[model samples]
Target: MTLSWSDPMFRSIVWQVVIIGGFAAIAWYLVSNTSTNLKARRIATGFEFLGRTAGIPIGEHMIDYEPSINTYGYALFVGVLNTLKVSVVGVVLATLLGTLIGILRLSRNWLISKLTASYVEVLRDIPLLLQLLFWYTVLQGLPAARQSFNPVPGVFLSNRGVKLPALNWEAPHLWALAAFVLGCVATHYVGKRADRIQDATGVRPRVWPVALGLLIAVPVAVWAALGAPWSIEWPVLRGFNFQGGLTVSPEYFALLLGLVIYTSAYVAEIVRSGILSVPHGQIEAGGALGLRQGVILRKIILPQALRVIIPPMTSQYLNLTKNSSLAVAIGYQDMVSIANTTLNQTGQAIEGIFMIGLLYLVISLSISLFMNWYNARVALVER
Candidate 1:
């Protein structure tokens, strides 16, 4: 007998259902057995313990969190904040420095190109953890407070860390921050308008003038109008230590420096490759049209190269953020450091590890999502 297309025999639906059911049964069995075994071993489960007191001090909390009063959840929040603080600043600085180096690596000047190449190679070859340790050691070896290196009258550098002038923010400072944010938004829109103008009329708008006006001029005007509510408190060597300034702890500095240097090497390579990926014909054509080298680079190459550079750079940023967990190695009191302390003090290994994993996952996912949006904006459409 021949089977028709609609025949039940022709479909594998029943078999598919059976296979899925079998897998589900196995999973259920495994879970049940594991739970029983854990219970027999007197191991606890669930996240109810998160509400309990953490009873561990987090040394560098941005929020008002005390070990005696705060819950495990609050402690985790502090850790997350510290991680973000290092990661965000590191990402911005690394990208800026790396792109400059990468562009330099492609320079016609032999010395500049070779020097950048050497920097990328040398830094990339060393382990990041080792680099962190090295930086920490260097900071530790700096002269004591009495003999601290003073690059400026207000700034002091010692084994403890760099002490720089801290700005005391007042009402005017809030206005300045608001103005700065507005400037960034305005610059973005200005760039978009310039692109549209270029597309329609082949005329490149002077983006720098507009950008400078928005970013600097507007912010300065607002700051001046608000009477500049900013006071600089400088560090002074007093009583065997520096006092009255923003002290960047050695651990924090070492971690930041290590993360920046290590991640910058990868970012530099990404940028160099992205720029090189741009067709030489495009540059020659820009030159043929009487555009200066700087104009060609700024108006043509960078915009195109950014699309290619951004995705991989995003991965590097994620790596840097994750690698910051190694801050525990040097006692930085980052999330991992404090979390480990909590685990030791409370004997809550499972809860601590889960918290650490979840915090990292959230950070990683957020960065990835933002990068995706940016990538979508910059990605080219092909016919």
Candidate 2:
């Protein structure tokens, strides 16, 4: 067989090969160049340094960490965990706050709508880092533990951080958590079965009763079966600072507040746009069917609007996660901050950067995949 340049298929194949080969060649050259430069500078490459003692002090580690005993790998792993904590909490808080503001934007009251609109506009326009700095500064200015603000019992807010009653987590709590997760899975199947039955019989089976049992009763039963220990460790003021309970460090709180507030503004716009995309007829039809406004918004409008909202919401999530790297600025000791420290101490710049990039790529892809799956679920399907 012979291939001619005149053949379109042959031309397309040749161009694709050429483009791919060029990219491959460039990548190879860059790798070789980095290796050569590193060798010439007597700077070690690869990840051998990860086993070395970190000897770096970290504040507010989730797990037990000591600079003297922990390896660089363990430090980096902890850093990744810190990053995830901020990103996960930030995403949930942002979604709730954003959704509320988004709904208020549609309110009939002029003041409510305008106030929310102003909030969104102001937050969206400002740089996120500046907001973080502002929050951190404000929190730093709070009075000492002795003069801490007590807005509620068992809660203390001060320069040190926000301290609240801490629960004694035990093995029973873990069992209860597992049961709750199982219950959620069961509830999902029940809802799916209910939907199928509704479609087949023109009568929707009740889902809430089953959901209540699965989501609540089962978890409680499991907890009780294991002794259900309940105790709160209260923060007590001692030696100019509060001790005991769980303290939310100022750095962490400020970082969380900044990320949630900033990202929520963008998310609010996405939600508002999604809601507005729904046809007015959809609302009128729900009203015609004697459905209350809350029911209409939840059962009809929001479900349909999710089809529009999820894709953009995923972007906001990624942005919020990535933006958490700015925790370095506020001394939150997140992934990027710790990675930079490792890079400096170990001089494994390339490896440090590569790991950081890889972690974020994994996170972003995970969020995107989940959002895409949900988007498909809610997408209008032809019967």
Candidate 3:
């Protein structure tokens, strides 16, 4: 009747059941409490409120939205587009600036390295909100429209906003944009082909020339063939204010600048660390094999360092995107800003906050998923 080793299967099954049951019990308890509290507060939850009219003006809506006609759902969609616009531009600009500064920090020239280090320290030490406030103040303090600073004939800078000539795009502009997209896709495939050819044969294909031809040449050719039916609408300083050009509001500019500079500092550090993580032996070996410095960096270092750089860069991007919520302080009409306004106007605090949280969560999760996929693609394998 003594216990035997052959009875191990029964014990394992009992433990597994106990562990799962415990987790399920905890989950049920939490949900039950949440629902009870919500009911006690007389709060009805779900997505029905999304259909209600959002009688609020969104200053910078990407889509044509009317305060009287559009629903909360449409307002939220506009907010989403604005958030994406800022985030995408910020990510691209930050990456470029950060990579340049990161490389400079490691430069052989002492002046360049020290200058870059100082830049990283100074920018990172300042609070992002303060920087945004400062930029906004500066923009607000500029001269009036009559004395607006015009660097070029059509571009006017003033307290009101930055005004620049815009293209009145006809059908040809759309065709050009389509051609540009196709050119980018073609260049990507061409790059892959070049790499494969280089790997298979000792001869390196001229990837940059081919890429330039596809990206610039093809797009220009298509644009020209379509008659280039676009005209520039110049800004003219009339009696009171500037007119006839696309104006970038001070709120938008300040938010964009602050996000870019603040995030670039963190991105710079990530890039520097990633580059440093590449073993010195690799560089030395490349040099020993008679490869030039530029060739070594482009061909050997970047591919390896990208694996280290991409994850932290992704985090910085997500941080910048979330930080855009601070636009509420400066009246940027971003998602958080619009949602806060809605909450105050409608007194639907729970619904407004839920929508805001959901939007941010979705954006963060999407970025994380993309970064995870990229990381998997570039991760080193060990046999």
Candidate 4:
């Protein structure tokens, strides 16, 4: 049968095809133009420069990196690792802190609520870059290693960094870590089994005790079996700086602090709004069932509020990740910073830029996919 314009479906299909074709045409033109322009400039292209020596000094690296010996590709990988370290840690800390602040914002006590409100207001208003700069400056103003502040027996804070006792990781630690992971998997299955039992028997079996055993007891047992070797290397004053311990660099600390504080404020608002979105009647019904206020919020309110909270929370997570690029401002070598350095030295501006964009795109998409999956899990399902 021939389609007619009068048919709504036919018209919709035609319009969608037109829009898609238009976008495709424009994309092709832009690509061709870029290639033509590059050719005219006689600039070298492709990712051949990635193999060349990087010779770029990176202060804080998770992986072993040598500036003079490492290739540009390896340097970029280190930069990616640095970015992931900050972004991942920041996301987790921001979520926990944000959830607490959001809950406190709804407290019955006026003082607590008002204080939390002010916190959200001030942080949301202040510029994150300024906050980062302020934190970095404050860290810089701390006394040098000679007059460092010893907070704990093995903890020292100074202009150089925060020195904490380092653990001499042994093979037993790896076995313990593996046991912990296995415990988590067992706990998940146990929880699922409990849920199925509840659905079938009209009563839920307690999973927490079993989870605790699996998550904690099993790991401890594994460590003990392997002869847990706990060795601590404490920091001691060297000539100009502290040595023989784990050091938290000022740049990383400031960046993490600024991201967590700033993002938590926004997350607080999201949490508050999500909780408030739940109808008062639900709380009343929960209370009528003789449930405590905390239980009511947990069992009834939060489960419902999550539907509203998750979508926006995903955006906050993405923002926190992208904001990590600002690490360059304070001399923290993140992906963008290192990529810029690579571009400058290699003169492969196009390739460097494409790689940077691609990396961020992949990272952002990964976060989005995970959040979306979790959201679906928490979403209300209708019979």
Instruction: Order candidates by lDDT, high to low.
Output: 4, 2, 1, 3
Put down candidate 1 lDDT per residue, 58-147, tens digits, no spaces: 767778998888998788789888888899999998998898898899899999999999999999999999999999999999998888
Task: Please report, in order, the local distance difference test score of every candidate based on alpha carbons.
Answer: 0.88, 0.94, 0.87, 0.95
Worst 10 residues of 2 by lDDT: 373-382
Of 1 and 3, the candidate ahead on lDDT is 1
Better of 2 and 3 by TM-score: 2
lDDT of 2 at 307: 87
Prediction-by-prediction clash tally? 0, 0, 0, 0
Q: In candidate 3, where is summed lDDT lowest over 10 consecutive residues?
A: 1-10
TM-score of 4: 0.92
Ranking by TM-score: 2, 4, 3, 1
TM-score of 1: 0.87
The residue-by-residue lDDT of candidate 3 on 165-258, one tens digit each, is: 9999788778878888998999899989888998899787888988888888888888899886668899887878777889898888989999
Candidate 3 overall Cα lDDT vs. reference? 0.87
Better candidate by lDDT, 3 or 4: 4
Local accuracy of candidate 2 as per-residue lDDT tens digits, 1-383: 58999999999999999999999999999999999999999999988889999999899789999999999999998998999999999999999999999989989999999999999999999999999999999999998888999999989999999999899888999999999999999999998999899889989988999899999999999999989888879999989788889999999999999999999999999999999999999999999999999989889998889989998999999999999999999999998999999999988889999999998999899999998898889887869
